[model samples]
Target chain A: MIRKLCIIGVGLIGGSAARRARRFCEEIVGIDADPENLRRAETLGVIDQGCASLERGVAAADFVLIATPVGAIEPLFRALAPLWRPDCIYTDVGSTKGNVVEAALRVFGIVPPNFIPGHPIAGAERSGVEAADARLFEGKRVILTPLPESAPDALARVEAFWMHLGARVERMDVGHHDEVLAATSHLPHVLAFTLARMLGRKDEQAEIFRYAAGGFRDFTRIASSDPKMWLDICRANRGPLLELLGEYETALREVAGLVRSDDADGLYACFSEARAAREKFLKSTENNHA
Target chain B: MIRKLCIIGVGLIGGSAARRARRFCEEIVGIDADPENLRRAETLGVIDQGCASLERGVAAADFVLIATPVGAIEPLFRALAPLWRPDCIYTDVGSTKGNVVEAALRVFGIVPPNFIPGHPIAGAERSGVEAADARLFEGKRVILTPLPESAPDALARVEAFWMHLGARVERMDVGHHDEVLAATSHLPHVLAFTLARMLGRKDEQAEIFRYAAGGFRDFTRIASSDPKMWLDICRANRGPLLELLGEYETALREVAGLVRSDDADGLYACFSEARAAREKFLKSTENNHA
Candidate 1:
């Protein structure tokens, strides 16, 4: 059992983690740059106590889970390196794993044995502590990318920690995790944001928006997600994200070319192939769930 | 009340229209080239009687609503023109208004005064008559793009017909309707289809799809739409679709450059603008309904 847990950035991811881990941990302390979030987390009983300073927050923490934005991870890691507790296990819930892993190397001159990089593949557009729910991780996938120097027992403990919180835990190398997530999550988000901007800027914007049905609403739903957090993710996962974005942009340009030349057969083929692929993917996913 | 209404093409959109119009029409006759659709539509009670031939179907109808693929519209309109009934008002539920209007002119040397172009913006990823729901158009917007030759009385009757069936009826010119729909619907659908195909064809497709979560599912929901119908829409609305798709591709490329250059501020601006626009659009849409 965890004696004390420190969850930094007590927003959606952190607060939800605390709420779910509350059962296993004796005490969960929340920390954030924003005092409003800490107050709300306390009011919601998401944390046993709130701390404004990193020192006070980490004072009693036997396990540390840094849940801050991707850009803040390196700075937080740098600060925490000097305050390292040798017996404490360290993990994070950042979207991009490469940056966090690199931060550990930069701070310690070697990857810390206790530092485990984790990313929970679950979130809602409505964020912050008020939107926190204990059941957020229920049936969700949590990926842990452990360092080469990661202690076997510490890795096992983090894996068990997520599993106990009802997450379907999995492990991968840090680079692969970042690449996979860049393709699946980051690229799709950028496309949604671009499409929303396209229609939102028209002269007949009101009419266009008025006629946008369920399909449009669903397609652009992710365009309403937190921009600052998404921006940080894009910057943090630059390499894989740029590669994937270039590939997607090429695909879109080809489609636009087909439409431009009135190539009905070409357009049909692309759309048909896409429909088949989506069907195959969804079918396999549903079967896996079953 | 619509008396002896004849509806051609008993598919999802047509089938749903018939089901909803049942309460407002007397003796609704369903016609389709596919006998299986006719059978299922009959079993589902979406239509009163199934007619195999267009001659037999529109023989006793006071109103004729052509509900076929956009490519099939011209031929259907040509055939109906030769069998024209001056008193029986004619209309069609085609996705592209400009194409349907041009077809009407080509078939009869001029658009018939009885002919009206209408498009109900409601659909599901699932197609076929079996997926028909009476409430598909509940609180949905149905745009009418009537020709200059269209009789005022016929336009009024067509408007009343859809309005009676629980749709919020609106009017626009054929060109504007095509342009608006190209931006709001066709562009987004193409993006979803492209993204789905991109991820599905990747080597780590299984892993990528496994962690797609809510954003990816919602974004790609329209990728599951019937490909043939979507292809027809792309072909019919080529001009506006190509223009919008090109503009969107350019916008996407700019964002991709921002990510590649690690320009967090630029990426943040784009994402923030998109989020604000989506929020504004949804807010106004909800308020309009309220």
Candidate 2:
């Protein structure tokens, strides 16, 4: 029986998961390097016990969730590998998966069958335990990419846990998962960041900033996400991100060529197709259930 | 004394402007080709009266704003030129100013000194009269592109009108306005539409749609904006938008090449720098008095 839950990092996702798991789990312990975060999580009742040290948090744990930055995940798993109870199941809430799995293999000697790689496709630009809410995952999708060696029972438990928190869980191969997320998530981040960088100059920033209505704010909001976290994500998922970036460049260049040549018909056809596609996708969430 | 106001196209911006102008002007009449939109505006108390004909809307007005699409504005202005009242000031709320101003001059024998080119940098992606709100322009920036022959009083009155509705107004030359907006607004829209078009597929869309979270929704939300409007914008501002698209492609290609070469350090640096710039912009906005 997975009676106790130990969450490392205790930020938005970590604290939210802890709060949601409270209904099912008997004990929830949270660990964070930041003291203020630990205090906030404790105040929010995200965890029954808050630990400043990793060792203290991992003790008496049936499940361990490392919710640190992508770059830190490898070192974290390495540090906890020997200390982690053999019976304890481990998982992570990283945005990208292939790098995380590879990092785990490097740290822990033979991949643990109890380890289930997972990513909860939910977040806000404003992060931290302060922004944590139990409903963050409500009606959202959480993707789990389990290795063939991963124990089915362990995978089932993780899926059940996420489902209890109102998340729709789905499974995919690690390589395919990275590529899809690159198109949907990583490439978008790159575009937002690039555009924000181009426009964020000190000279033009005031004018650009003043002109930001709902569309600009909404479009570039993710560019304001945690720099360290995104840096780690880019470094880890560089391959797939680059592939999507190439695809994005091809599309942009084609439109640019059209615009340069004053091809109004071509431009109109492109925009029309995209607009139709966006409408269709937004109007349907039925595929999410499947 | 600008006691009466006339607004053309009674859609979101036109209807909202009519409602907000009521606070400053004694009477507001709206003209729309779509009878349903005009009727809806009348019922919503956004205007004092509705007219199906452009001449009827502009004939007895102190101030007339042609708030139609870029393509429609030229024809609307041409149709009303014969019936235009000499004392009545004319302006337009079109996205691209150079095209509209040139169109106005080519269509009208003599462009009125009171004609001001303006764009209120505020709107929701959701369009139509029903979505119009008087508070849409509140605390937003309204950019005016004044010609060399523009009447000083007329320009000031237009600025003051926007100010009275709680907007901060700025003035720029039409050519400069197009270039700036191309970088800050038009290019972003192009990128959003292109990304959506490239990634959107009938079979793969289901999974991509399912995996879409905060980042994807925020970045591509504008992709769902009206295609006809965007297509017109692309055609009208083709030169600057094409140049800006090239700049974006240059950045995208650099990142793509680094990713292809497995240069994790380069990718991390790029992501971090972009994120930092975005953070700085977000922080600066919080300090603005407006």
User: Which candidate has the highest lDDT of all?
Assistant: 1
True-vs-predicted CA distance for residue A240, candidate 1, Å: 0.8
Model 2, B1-290: lDDT tens per residue? 46778888888888888777777788888888889888988998888899876766777788888788777877777787788766878888888888988887888755578788899887777888888888988877789999888899889888887888788888988888888888767888888888888878622534576677767877888998888788888888887787777777777777667667767777667766777776665665564434
With a 3 Å backbone cut-off (N, CA, C), the pairs that clash in candidate 2 are none
Docking class of 2: medium
Clashing pairs in 1: none
| lDDT per residue (tens digit) for residues B197-279 in model 1 | 88888834445777667788888889998888999999899999888887987898899888888887888899998998898
Model 1 lDDT per residue over A36-82, tens place: 87898998899999998899889868899889988898789888877
Question: Which 10 residues in a row give candidate 1 chain B its minimum summed lDDT?
Answer: B203-212
Candidate 2 regions exceeding 4 Å error are A33-45, A50-56, A202-206, A286-290, B1-3, B23-26, B43-45, B108-111, B202-206, B261-269, B283-289
> lDDT score of model 2?
0.81
In candidate 2, position B214 carries an lDDT of: 62
Give the worst 10-residue stretch by lDDT in candidate 1 chain A: A198-207
lDDT of 1 at A127: 84
Taking the tens digit of each residue's C-alpha lDDT, what string does model 2 give over A75-131? 887888779676888889999999988987888765688989999998888789888
> Native contacts recovered, in order, as a fraction for each?
0.81, 0.70
